[model samples]
Target: MSKSTSLLAAVALVVTGGVALADDTKVGILMDITGPIASFIPPLQNAANLAVNQANEQGGLLDGKAIAVFGDTTGSAQGAVDAAGKLVNIENVPIIMGSLMSGTTIAAAEAVAIPAGVVQISPTATSPAITDIEDNDLMYRIVPSDNYQGEVLAKMVLEAGNKEVAVTYVNNDYGVGIGQTFIEAYKAAGGKITSAVKHEEKKDSYRSELATLSQAGGSALVVIAYAGDSGGKIVKQSIEGGLFTNFIGTDGLRDEALINDIGAEALATSFFSSPTSPADNPNQGTLHELYNAAYGEGADKAFVDQTYDATFLTLLAIQKAGSTDRAAMAAALRSVASAPGEKVGPGEWAKARKLLMDGKDIDYDGAGGSYDFDKNGDVSGYIGKFVVDGNSYKQTEVMQ
Candidate 1:
C-alpha cells in the first residue's frame, strides 16, 4: 500500500472511532445528590453507574455505548424542575432514572419529562400518589408504593405490642403518603394514633412538634421523614429533649446520615422499614456480590437494588426499540419487562445483551426481585426492618 493510502486508512479509522464515541447514548440520572436526601445518593449513584458500565462492556444498546448524565435535585421541587429541564432539553436523554424522592420525581415528571416526551424510572419514590398520577405512563418506579410499606410497618408495630403511638411526618408527598397509609392501616389493624403532625423541612428545630407529638406519651414516635434533612433533626431533637425514647421510622429515615446525627448507640432501641431483596431471590445475592466487590457493603444499601433495576430496564428498552425515539422506547418498556422470555438474572447485562442480539425474548428478574410493572408503572416488592446493633445497622426482618 502507498504511504498516502495507509495514512488515509488510519485517518478513516480515527474518524469512525470518534463517531462511535459521539454516538454514545446518555441516560439522565436525576437524583437528590445535593438536596435533602444527599446522603443516600452516593451508593444509589454507584449502583446506576455500575449498570451503565455493564451495558458499555456488553457493547451497549445497539452498538452504541451508554453514559450517565447526572443532575442534582437539590431536594426541592424547583430544583427537580431545573435539573430535569437540563436533562431533557440540553442533554437530550431519551430516558431518566431517578429523583429518588417522591415529590421531586412527580415535579420533574409532570413539569418536565412527561410533556417533553421522556420516560422516567424512579428507584425509590414510593409514594402512593405516584400510582394515581396522570403521567402519560411515563413515570415508573422500582420500589413498591408506601401503601405496602406503611401497612407492614403498622403490623410490625402491633406485633411488638404497641397499641397507640404518636406520629410526625415531613410536609411532603413521601412523608404524607406513607403517613396517611400508616394511619389507615394502623387504625384498621386496631392500633390508634394519639397525634399526627406535619412539619416542613430545612427547619433548624423540631422541638415544638416533638413536644406536641410526645404529649400523648406512647411507646414509640413514628418519624416519616428523610434522614439527611428534617428526619435527622427530628430524631436528634426528640432524643435531646428526652421525649420519646423508642422510635419507628420509614424508609426515609433509614440511612447512615441519620446514624451520623444520632449515633449508633442512640438508634439501638429503634427500628425502621425500607425496601429489600427477598432471601429466596438468588439473583439478589449474585448482584450484591458484584456490587459489594467494587463498592464495599452495597448489599443492604437503600435503593441500590432498585436503582440498578431501573437503569438496567431503561437500557434494555432502548436496545429493544433500536432507536432513541420516545414513543418506541415507552412501547418497548413493559413488553421487555414482563412475560414469557428467557430468564436474565441481576448483574447479567452481558447475558441479556446476547439474548436480545439473537432475537430471543428475555425476562429480567433483578436484585429487587421479578418485575411486573403494573399499568401505573409500579411494582410489588418486599420491605425490611432495619435495626441498629452496636455500631452498625442490620436488617432483622423481611416483611412480605
Candidate 2:
C-alpha cells in the first residue's frame, strides 16, 4: 500500500465490545522522536516498522494487519506520560514497544503503562533505576541495564590505561545512573575520578564546566549524555576550547551525529561502550541484510536491532495470548521470550505463528540476544567497545 493509504487505514478506527476493529491489531510504539535523541529516531523507526511489516506480510496479527500507532515522547517526562496516555487510553494498544530514553520510559511506565496494566518492552532504556521500579511485571527492556553497561565501561576505560578521568553527565536518569556507577566502579578498580559534574541539558555553553574539569588535570573526560543534546555540544565545545583530548563515553554518546558535528579526527583517541549483540549471533547478520534491503542503510545503527527485537517480541506476545487482553500479555511474553521452547529467530513470524497454532511453545532469539527476561523484566546482554570508523562506529570488542 502507498504511504498515504497506510496512514489512512491506520486511523480508520472503530470500536466493538471495547476492542478495535477486526481487521486491525494496533500496537503502540512510544519513541523519543523530537527531543534530545531525535537523531536516533529515524533508523529506530525503520526497525520497528520492519517488524510490523514482516508480521503483516507473513500472516498479520491475530487475523488482521498489525498497525503501529506511534506516540512521540518529546524526550521529556511530561511528554512521555502524555504520549503513553494516548497509546493506552485512546489507541487502546494491547502492548507498547518503547520510549527509548530512561527518563521517558520510567515516567511513562509509572504514570501510565503500569497503572493501566499494558505491557511495555523498551528497546534501549538502560538506566539502572529501571531494574528496581515497582512495575509489577509490566515493564521490560530488551537491552541490559546501565548498571551492567557502567561496570563494563569502567573496565573498558581502565583497560585503555586511563587511570584518572574527569566526568560530566547530563542531569537525567540516563546520565546519572550510568555516570555514578561508572565512577564508583572506576574508583573501586584503582582508577581516580579527578572531578565529577552533573549538568542540566540544553545549555548554550558548557565552557565553565569544561574549564573546571580540564583544570582537574585528568588525562581524559568521561561523558555520559545524549549525543543529540548535551553530549555532542560538550564534545564540540571541548574541542573548540582545546580541553581534554581523550574521551570515554557510554551508549548515549555513541551517536553518529557526534562524529558529524565534531568530526572523527577529534575522537580518534576516544571509544564508547554500548549494549550490543553476541559476537556470534548469526541472526544479527540475517536481520542486517533484511534491514538494509528495506531501508537501504542504517542496519548497523544503534538500537536498530534492539528496537526490531522489541517490536517483534510484542507481536509474538499478542499472538500467543490469542487476543488483546492486557492481563494475558505478561505470561504470553514469558512463554515466547524465555527458554525451553522451539527456537524462533528474526523474521520467522510465519513459522512462529504456525507453531503457536499447533499448540507448541517457541523461544524468540532475535538479532540482539536470546531474551531471557529476569523476574524484573530485564535481560542479560553484551556490551561492545566501539570506535569511530568513518562516519559510523565499529565494534572492537564485546564484553559480557
Q: Please give the lDDT score for candidate 2.
A: 0.90
Cα TM-score per model:
0.93, 0.95
Evaluate model 2: give its TM-score.
0.95
- Residue 314, candidate 2: alpha-carbon lDDT: 96
The ten-residue window of minimal lDDT in model 1 covers 9-18
Error of 2 at 230 (Å): 0.8
Per-candidate clashes come to: 2, 0
lDDT for residue 274 in candidate 1, whole number 0-100: 93
Per-residue lDDT of model 2, residues 1-400, tens digit only: 3463233223322222224467788999888877888778778878988998899889988978788888878888998999899999998999999979999999999999999999999999999999999998999999998888889999999899989899999998999999999899999999999999999999999999999999997889999999999999898899899997888899899998899898989899999999999999999999999999998988999999999999999999999999999999999999999877899999999999999988899999999989999999999999999999999999999998
- Which portions of model 2 miss their true places by more than 4 Å? 1-21
> Which candidate achieves the best lDDT against the true structure?
2
